[model samples]
Target: MNIAYLPIDERPCNTDYVRRIADSSAEVKLFLPPQEALGYKKLPADKEMIWKWITDVASEVEAIILSIDMLIYGGLLPSRIHYLRNTEATLWIERLRSLRKEHPGLLIYASNLIMRTPKYSSSDEEPDYYEEWGEHIFLRAYLQNKKQREHLKKDEELQLQNLIDTIPKKYIDDYEERRAFNSTINTSMLKLVKEGTLTFLAIPQDDSSEYGYTSIDQAKVMKGIEALRLHQHVQMYPGADEVGATLLARVYTQLKGKRPRIYPIWSSTLGPQLIPMYEDRPYQESLKAHIFAAGCQLAETATEADIILAYNTPGRVMQESWDQSDKDITYTSFRHLLTFVDQIKQFLNQGKQVIVADCAYANGGDKELITLLDEERLLDRLLSYKGWNTNCNSLGTTLCQGVLGLQGNKQKIIENIIYHIIDDYIYQAEVRMKMVEDFLPLHNLTYFNLKDKVALVNKERNKRVRDAYQLLIRHSFETITRLDVQTFAPWNRMFECGLILKCEQSEVSKKC
Candidate 1:
C-alpha cells in the first residue's frame, strides 16, 4: 500500500525513523516531502510546499500519516514561536476539512503534541528568554501544579505563591498564553476527530514529570476525550517522537488483519518500571500503550508468543556514556547482564523469533551487551536490534519490525536486519562513542551552537557512518545487492542520527 507521511520536524527521530520502518514492510510503499523544505530546531518548515505536497499525494496513497504541528506551524519549534491570529491558526483545520471533502474515504492518521516545558535553560528549541528563566518558570509550574494536587500547608502555600510572584508576570503570562493557545488548537483537532475526519488520532504528551504543565494539560485533555466519548479512535500517551512509527504500525496491522502476540523480557526486572528522563510514567505503561496503539496483543509467556522482545535496561538509573565513563563495564559475572544474554540465547535456541531492544542506557547502546552479542555471533542473527535515542523510540521501532516479521516477508526482514546492524551495533556501539571523544570539543570551544558547526559535524558524521556501512557491505558483498544513505544529526548533536536509506537484498547480511 502507498503511504504518505508528514513528519513533525526534520530531526532524524521524527523524519527518518517512521519512513524507514514503514518502507521495510513488504505491504508498504512510502513517500515523503523534500528534506530541504522541512524545519530544524531554529528554522521553520516550508508550509506552502509541504501543504501542496500533501494535497498532491493524498489521493494517490492508501493512507496518510500527518503531523498536525507540521501542517499548522511549519514545525515543532515553529509551533512554539509562531504568531498567528485565531482565524489564521485554525486554517489548518480548514485545510483538513477541505481534504476530507476532496477524498471522501481517505484513511488519515494524525498526531498532536501536548506542549513541553523544558526543565533546563536551552534556547535551542525555546524562546530566547528561556535561556535564563526557563528553569525558574518550570519550577513555578511544578510547585503550582503540586499545590493543586496535594493540600499545601500555610507556609508551603505562601512559599509556592511567593515563588510564583517572583517570576516576572509577563514571562509567566507569555508561557501560560502559549500553553493556552496550544490547548485550544488541540481541542479543535479533537472535534475534527469526533466528526469523522480522522481515522485515528494520537495526542502524545511530549515531555513529562510528576508535577508540571503536562499533568495540568493531561487532566483537561482526558476530560475532552471523555466528553467526545470516542473509543479506539483517539488516545493520549507519554511519547511524542514514537507516535508516528506506532501509528504506521497501526495502519499496517489493519491492512494485514493480524494482531501478533509479543512477550517482553528485560535485563533487569525493574527495567519496565524504570522511567527515564523526559517521560511522566514508567516504561511498562508506555510499552502497553505502544502495543495497543499498534493494534497488537501482549503475551504472558514466551512459549505462547509469536515474538520475543528482549529489552536491555539499566539496573538502577539509565546513564549515558558521558556520565558513566568512570563506571566499570559489565562482565559475565554481572548477573543482570549475564542472565539477560543467557535468556536471549535460550530463546534463540528454542526457535523463537527474537528482537532486541538495547536500551541499557538513554542516549546510546550498551557496550557490554553489544560486546557479548558480537562474541556469541548473535549480533546479526536476531530478527532485529535497536538502541537509539529514547527507550520508547527504540522500543516502538523494534516492536513494529518484530510484529511485521511474522508475515514472513523475506525482503522486509533482510532490510530490517541491515538497519539493526548499522544503527544499533555499528553506530550506537562503536563509531558514536569514538566520535564524541574525538570531536565533542570542536574548535577549542565547548557548548558551541550547532548552527555555526553543523556542517563540519555532519560532514564527519556522514564519512564515519557511511564508511561503517560500506565496510560491513564489503564483508558481505555477495549477499548485499545495494545500499543508500543520508546520515546526519538534525538536532545538531550526536545523541541520535537521521539515517534515511533503503537496501535491497534477498539474504540477511550480519557480521561483526
Candidate 2:
C-alpha cells in the first residue's frame, strides 16, 4: 500500500495528476520526491538527490515506480538533450541493479520513454539547434526510415535528398548520436526485465508517427522484447505523460487482486478504426494495449463490466480541438452525439459505473460532447472523464482513473472529475488560445514565453477558467455549491497550465 513514485518530470500531468488519482483510492499511500529535486523545465534534476531519496524510502515502501528518464537523464526533456555516453548510462543501469539486489522482494515497476522527434521547429523542449533544423531533422529520419519499409515516390526521394544536402551534417550527427545512445539504454532495460530485476516495464513512445525515428526505435525495442520473451512482462505503446498513472493503476489493481473489466462504446462506428492525431495506430489498438497495461481487461458485454467507457470520437475525420468551431461535416453526418449520451444514461440507470473518454478532437475536449453530458446532468455521477492532448493521453489517464474509482473515495472521485472538466474542457478546449491571442497581445507577450508577466497571466487565466467552469459545470451540477480555482503557468507557457481546485459540495469539501 505504500509505494514510492518518481515522475517523468515536474509537470502537473506527471506529478500532480498521479497524486490526485492515487488520492481517489483509500488504500494507496503514495510518496514522491521533493519538488526541488525534480528540477525545472529543460534543466535536468539532481540524479544524486533523487537516488538518495529513492534509497532512503526503499526500506519503508512495498513497491516503487520509477521513470528511467528521470533516473538516468534527470527528466523527460533532459533525455532528449542529454550528452551522456554509454558508460554513464550503464552506471545508472548498474545502480538500478544494485537497488534490485538490495531489495529482493520489492515489487518494482518502471517506465522509460522512446525519445520523440517533433515534426515542427521549436527548441522549447529540445536543443537550441532544433530551433532551426527540427523539422528537417525529423523529415530526414522519417524519409530514410520510410524508404526501408516501402519505396518512396520520386518527389519524396528528391525532397529527402534536398533535405540531406541543405541541413548541416553536424546537427544530424548530434541528433542521431543521442538517439543511438538512448536506444542502447532501452535495450539494456529489456535485459533487466528479462532477468527478473523488474516486475513490469513500460516503454512509451512520445509524440510518435508511423514512419520515423520513433518507429525505428520501437522496432529495435520490440526485437529485444521478442528475444527475451518479455511479451507478458513489458508493454511498448504510444504515450508519455500518462504512463506513470497507468503503472500506478496496474499496481493498485494487481495488489487488490482485482482485474476490472471495461466495456467501450464509441460515438462513431469508424472512430476506433481511424487513428487520432499524434499516434501511430488505430484508437482501438492503443486502447486495448492501454487496458492490459493498466492491469484491466476488455468486457464483451456491459452487464459483465466494472466500468463503461463512453468514448466520444470523431465521425470520419479527426481534427484539433481548437478547430471544432469551424466544424467538420463528417462529425455531424457520421457521428451521433445525442445517441452517445443516451447510451451513457442507460448504463448509469442499469447501475453500471460509466466513464467518458471525450476524445472527439485532439489537444482538448469536445464542446458538443461536454454540452450533451452536462444537459443530462451526468457530470457529477460518472466515475471519471478526460479529454486532453493526444487520444492515448486522454484514454490512458481516464482508464487509470476509472480502475481506481471502482473502490475509491466518492468525494475524491467527484472532485477529480470536476478538476478535469475545469482543466481538459474549460481551460484547454476553451480558454487557453483565447487568452493567448486576445489577452496576451495586450500585454505584448508570447504563448511560448510569459517572461515577467507570469502572475498577470495566471490571474487572467484563473478568472477565465472559473468563469468558464461556472457556465459549463456549476450551473448543471448544483451539488457543487462553491468552487475556487487557481492556475499556474508551469514553465511559464500557455501550452499547459497547472490548476488547484477547492470544492464545497452539499455533502463535503474536497480540495484537489
Candidate achieving the largest lDDT: 2
lDDT for predicted candidate 1 compared with the true structure: 0.75
Over 1-35, each residue of candidate 1 has an lDDT whose tens digit, in order, gives 88888988887667666766665566788889999
- Identify the runs in model 1 with alpha carbons over 4 angstroms from their true place: 152-162, 327-335, 408-442, 445-448, 451-455, 458-487, 491-495, 499-512
Any residue pairs clashing in model 2, and if so which? Answer: none
Compose the digit string of candidate 2's lDDT tens values, residues 119-206: 9999999989999999999999999999999989999999999999999999999999999999998999999998888899999999
Report lDDT per candidate: 0.75, 0.91
**Cα TM-score of candidate 2:** 0.98
Residue 141 CA displacement from its true place in model 2, Å: 1.1
What TM-score fits each model? 0.87, 0.98
Every candidate's CA RMSD: 3.7, 1.7
